[model samples]
Target: MTAQPNSTEARDMAYHLHSYTNPRKLEREGPLIIDRGEGIHVFDNSGKRYIEGMAGLWSVAVGFGEKRLVEAARRQMDKLPYYHTFSQKAHGPVVDLAEKLIGMAPVPMSKVYFANSGSEANDSAIKLVWYRSNALGRPEKKKIISRIKGYHGVTALSASLTGLPNNHRSFDLPLANILHTTCPHYRTGAEPGQDELAFSRCCAEELEALILEEGPETIAAFIGEPVMGAGGVIVPPEGYWAAIQDVLRKYDILLIADEVICGFGRTGNMFGSETFGMRPDIMTLSKQLSSSYQPIAALMINDSVYEPIANEADRIGALGHGFTASGHPVAAAVSLENLAIIEEKDLVGNVRRLAPHFLGRLNALERHPLAVEARGIGLIGALELEAADGAAAGATGARVGAILQRNGLICRNIGDSIAFCPPMIITAAEIDEMFDIVEASLGELGQQAAA
Candidate 1:
């Protein structure tokens, strides 16, 4: 039903232009303005509670209404509301968070550069890659390779790094010196009779072939999500990362793990790099960094990647890179508290314990008539829908997702897949409850499709 032209809906339609949304549809149907949240659930303007299955854009790891995060923000606000880390100036929160992140890194990291969002962090990483290569007197080594369907971020450079066509179609994106490799989804991209391991080799060969075709000297880095999140929560085929990393290492290309969604125990590890054996030269983190309570993101670079940039900065007399709120004190404080809560509550261990039930319930959805496959790891999962007869791709999944939304379960539909990544704090019973709604919604969708 189209929402009535009430104050909230009317104002939203009047003043807001939402990202990744069809504005025409928003004009007709309006928005679900959430009023509040508790735990993993949010209440709409009408006070109807729904499970935030996607965890508010795949962040919110510690869950909603987390008092510790709130109090942390408040305490920081009271102490030092805002401070900038530029021109050698630093604050306690920023310094402390950096130290904590460095110590907890999956691989040894030299420094942390803070940004306000995932997009900025990724865009900055690209710039850093270019800067580093130039500093090393390899200015031609500027091209970057990302996989098809990889979701990096939406800023200019970051969106170019993103492989989704929709993000680039009208934006004149993928600006230049950017190349794409084949998606690592073995289920759909593999050759007939080829196994996953073999397909992984094929993917690596494709990367190597691309590097050769483009001239290895021109390619500076390869960035990828540890588990592709917005791109249907794709877990790469077995041996995929190892093979791909081998090729990158051979070409002397830097590897960047974009752990924006898969970080903070989402993949049952501190970072997705650990979940999958990726020793990235650089890493981008966001989403759960501050639990989305305050916008924050960061990039960590290993010594090899950092040294050139540091030298370049020394040579140039200034780094010439940073945001005004690069390391805002409040965001850093909130992030520190979020990590501490995760530690105190053993949230990572909880995700490990609860993942089996989560994945089991998710995999069981494959039996649904409309489901083509159910794929998941840790707390993240997706149900790829079978296209209805004579319908376009993603039509059935979108329809079913809309039905699920109406039934009070919020998830995201990417192409034909509906993704679910609840907060790490979710309980086993809540996992079951979330899937109960999913089963009911899918069953209804099946009946509707048949009808």
Candidate 2:
């Protein structure tokens, strides 16, 4: 038998495999091993503090170590630790949460379905679209369309729906029926002298063209994030969503707003769909729903989408789709408590008040030599680093990201862009501190690139 490892690094290397990590590099460097978190910062096992600029994977809205969330989990665990929302079984937390989500939905929603993660919620949405199409008697309407830079999730069908190449490579993903539309990013899509409105029209035309090429009868849904989150926080160009939704409506394509990142005050609203005027037929939500205190996700369906499915389930005598932990009592209880805290603390109002400050700080970086573009909404933002005269697309991005990490601000390096998504609970002083660190890092990187 092999001997057990003693060091944290050794144990992690022996047993842990991390997602989105370079396996070979992890074997060499091991994990940072975060010990705990408070507010918008996390401490490594060595006591090194990092301003969690990405909000613990774009969630953690209320920040870390909220006693209310902890107490809520403990209360539920004591009262009813485990209960499934399957086979006609239900629990108070689940029922209450469903009501709360429906009431809070930007658009009118008929029901809520619980899942374990954003990926699961997205996967369920895909299944629901297919089932809805089948119920409408158009079995051919199964293909789903997403944009090139949009991020849905990472499950089988959801990963297929994801527009990024890396998510699809080596995974045999984007399964069979998933189609992609043009990314509505003007900076990348623009030709010389192309106006934003023209770019918007171009995107609409491209989507319409794709739908025509695929045949509208074969397309079931169109899914997208309100602001492209993992895809470098790319906000849509002027009139982008308006035009895209027009095309989808014309073709009768169901819209699925993947609000996993943009939901829950991340975009200065309760939901991104509201901020962006995206009237989706269905919505997938996670992340801030429980402030990442516990694992939970939800799918909100409109009456147009849910009634058929409910009827089909009644006719078929079984739904046959659900995780054992779906709507787990402990998670639902924590999520309910999290929502209450968000409302009581007026976190959404805080986001609206602080967003201009955050955006001002990020926009200030535009004049920095290495910064090509600085864009964001609410607390979520990105600074795209310009490549050296002839350097590769992501070369400077890697250097800037390393510099930021060393400077104690941990942000996401998505290609040539650095993404920032501070917790909704971030104070004005902490916001200033975060920008100061980022500015220092950018200055150092700019000097290095110039040299």
Candidate 3:
């Protein structure tokens, strides 16, 4: 055992600045330094192993320590370490990856622009929408709308596009033209006797009203996640996307599908756009593109959106926008190889076959004392804990999450909901193991609540 640090916890507290974390709480609790991973499991510094339930923040589609991906990165690094796609410059790997992405797009996509992360991809998407609207002589159509619980990304415009309160509070976000409508969660948002179809209509009506209230001419785009990931794994009500798309079409507003989390077989589809019947004018892709083996992302746009943006760029001398590491050759190569592996191994098929089993097991937890709701689609699921004695649910979700960590499972707590997004490579037996631990933890929590 590599001589454990004398004051490792204190050292982490002193040096690291974590994202989306309570800094003070981090100072007190310290970091849980993960050492390495194999397959769908990761090991900590103490050699304790735990299933990577959230796929390392909902990326890592191929799981960890994938040798083929590592080899792809190495081969690309040796041949052409790095290159930029700016100022008309490009490389083979980047070009090939872009072609593959455009070809694989669920809807007909005219172009693919590369970026370094989901946030950057989404931020670029926002800029493209505004630029395209301006090029078409609709500068007033600069406002973007997203759902209240929908998560886009964390950069300036993207964060504004994100509808979560925490992403906006004290940051002065939602930056002027961004607007958020209602979250279409039937279990939580539905009125008495309101069925899924009724809830879907309500969502559509509410969205149309918002557009009218703001004047549809002011709205340029509407962005959404097909299956809400960070905001409690909210799968939309039936007919939700169809109704929402009708509203967008009626107003001539573009739809931007933020597939950062659900892309690349998470929902048993190549893209969530296909699964949810979303024909987005623009789509953002990341997370599973390189299976978290490399830091990369892509923004795909259809001909309608791309043609205007391209024409505008020609008129402006240059787009004047790009990241230094956009389409990095090494990342692109690895991403291509990752996609090949996903296809070769029939990972999407696995997800489709296993989804019903996973959902069945998760739904069984609904009647548990600590579980108020059990919701999931494909491999992503959540168990929402109810408040004890009417106190407040989700308040204790994080505490329960910590307990789950102690019980040898690693998942996420999103506002009183315990989210599970195991890697797509996880087997049926492993699924049983994961939920067994979850059941144990819930049982303990239930006993504690009763006491």
lDDT of 2 by residue, 1-451 (tens): 9789999998988888889888888998778789999989999999999999999999999999999999999999899999998778999999999999999999899999999999999999999889888888899999999889788888888889889998999999879999998887789898899999889999999999999999999999999999999888989988889999999999999999999999999999999998889999999999999988889999999999988888888888987689999998999999999999889999999999999999999999999877889989988999998887788877788778888888899898998999999999998999999999999998897677668
> Model 3's lDDT to the true fold?
0.91
Off by over 4 Å in 3: 1-8, 390-393
Q: What 10-residue stretch in candidate 2 is worst by lDDT?
A: 442-451
Clashing pairs in 2: 160-174
TM-score of each candidate? 0.98, 0.97, 0.97
RMSD of each: 2.2, 1.4, 2.5
**Superior candidate under lDDT, 1 versus 3:** 1
For model 3, name the residue pairs that clash: 394-416
- Descending-TM-score candidate ranking: 1, 2, 3
Q: What TM-score does model 3 achieve against the real structure?
A: 0.97
As a whole number from 0 to 100, the lDDT of residue 111 in candidate 1 is 96
In Å, residue 132's CA in model 3 sits off its true spot by 0.6
